[model samples]
Target: MQTPSFYFSRICNALKLAALVCLFLGTSPTWLHAQKSLSNELRAASEQFLATLSSEQKALANLPFDSEWRYDWNYTPRQRKGLPLKQMNEVQRKAAMHLMKAALSNQGVAKAEAIIGLEYVLREVEKRPENDTYRDPENYAFAVFGTPDAQQPWGFSVEGHHLSLHFTVVDNKVEFLPSFFGSNPGIVLPGYVQEGKQVLKEEADIAFRLLGSFDEQQLKKIVLSEKAPNDMLTTNTRKVSLEKREGLSFGEMTSAQQKLFQELLTVYLNKYHVTLKNQELARLRQADMNKIYFAWMGDREPNRGAGRGHYFRVHGPTFLIEYDNTQNGANHVHSVVRDLTNDWGEDLLKAHYEAAHKK
Candidate 1:
């Protein structure tokens, strides 16, 4: 059995050959014609971003696709591998943001920007100094792995405090996985920069609605623990797994309950472009929906204190979604969507490799 990375390398070589063949034949390959329109748009944005960078900045922003750092992703307040937004000039920053926008829906972009803006709210809440290390919205970094070419395998990442978005493209196929979004002061009450603004409001509210619909007997199966965990169980791990599958199965839910659960799932899935989102939805529809589970932990009621400790997770055969508001007195929010077998494009790479090798 060969590793996925090994197949990834072989796929790159095969794609390079395919590119040459297409050029020689004066015709586009089927894969090229079949490429997602969004992938092409994103590649153009990525190239535009690179064009705006100085040599030094470009060096910092680009890295080998196979570098160990490719998997070194996290949603924490710390230094990262790519160029931080603060270091980019206004033009460059705009270019970088364009690349980001290319990968997200309009609503997703709004939510991401709102999450970044919350750093200021956190600074005010903590009363930190001007040079506060953990509260700068511009602290986010952007990095590209491999060259941004439509015919080859490459990827990009935007990561920083409370947000980590990754995209991998190969032969025009895009993989959006290991994506994270978080918020401090999850719900903004009065007196903040944006009063009554909740960055992840839909995520929390829908879960609440779904849980509320559960009867006492159903609740018994869904509430996995008396206490909510302080953070997501799969935080920043290269490989993620849950110790147990304890929750109410999708098969147990009423039709209305199932609809609500799916609506909640759509909130997360909608983070990507429609092309990619549709592809993901198609794969999800093919899965064993009856095997999916929904689990909640911690207090169901609203918290009046400085923070509320609430957590919930939706687990399916191929995907896992985790949302937690147990940190910072429950004022902070962390949520992640992971494709169990496809994070970092493992499945895509594998299939591409096998197909290319077979040919």
Candidate 2:
């Protein structure tokens, strides 16, 4: 029987020929048409959600464009500073969800909902009280920053336990970064709701498959250490900068390995709305893929029931993707994607401020 890599290699060879022809002819990918109007869609959704908020709720849900809270995000199960679903009426909560639907793709929406629902699983596993608000799914908070305008700069965030998502828009372009999604009891054990399920299964499995195909020399280049980090190296930091770059470069990979890496990245990128995904995908296609690096630590193989302590990161010039499963006997997972230059719309805001100062 042929290995998974064999199939990937064949597929990649076909894509390479088509990609070369497109590049030579200066033609764009078909996804160009998919970028119809993410900015307008987001503005409409934000407006609708805000309209449902009562005056008191608006007081908490709305803030200035430059508010410090715009960047204050966390994925821990703690009291957050936004209008939570628990405080919103059914109509308001539905609107809030609509806003999320506008920002995330179908896959992303499912993951977001699943991550929220995991709180119930946690409540049962931890044996919390019926009235306990600590693990409440409704604890996720939603907030909009500045006014929603088609041409103006503004942002929004929905953050809570195991999830922190942020979106910034300037003119008609949207920037989403520092996005996080996590799972406790990463694999749902028997007797719980959604038993024997893993929301982030693809993330680990795809990576493991790629690792498994590597030879001893390839493993030495990628695996940094035998012990994994306790959490993401850049956990919720206001600003992140990695002084040292480590791991195996994409140029070093075989054709099949490169295809696997691209597939792994698509799993993360596909979480966003198509417009955003296409926009980013276009940038990636034009980027120097050889600069991208893949690094791993801890177990070479995945141990399912109670996971093995493992971590991996895809670091490149433009972005960083990190995944760690070291807590809860390695059954808890923390994964995040951070934009190197534009977390919290750093580049966009900078340009806006410069243009403002000129006038």
Q: Compute each candidate's TM-score over C-alphas.
A: 0.88, 0.90
Question: Candidate 2 residues 9-128, lDDT tens each?
Answer: 999997995675454322644432233267788899999999988899999999998889988988898988779999999999999999988999999999999999898899999999
Angstrom error at residue 84, model 2: 0.2
Best by TM-score: 2
Clashing pairs in 2: none
- Judged by whole-model lDDT over C-alpha atoms, candidate 2 comes out at 0.86
On residues 1-359, what C-alpha lDDT tens digit does candidate 1 reach at each position?
A: 99999999999997886664553322555434434676788889999999999999999999998888889998888898899999999999999999999889898999999998888888887788767878998899999999998666899999989889999998777888889999877887688777777898888888999999999999999998878999998888998888666799999999999999989988887877766665666566557678889999999975723555889999988889999998878878899999898899987788778888898
- Look at candidate 2 and tell me the lDDT of residue 132: 79
Model 2 lDDT-worst window of ten: 24-33
* Root-mean-square deviation (CA) per prediction: 10.0, 5.8
**Candidate 1 segments whose C-alpha is farther than 4 A from its true place:** 1-35, 304-308
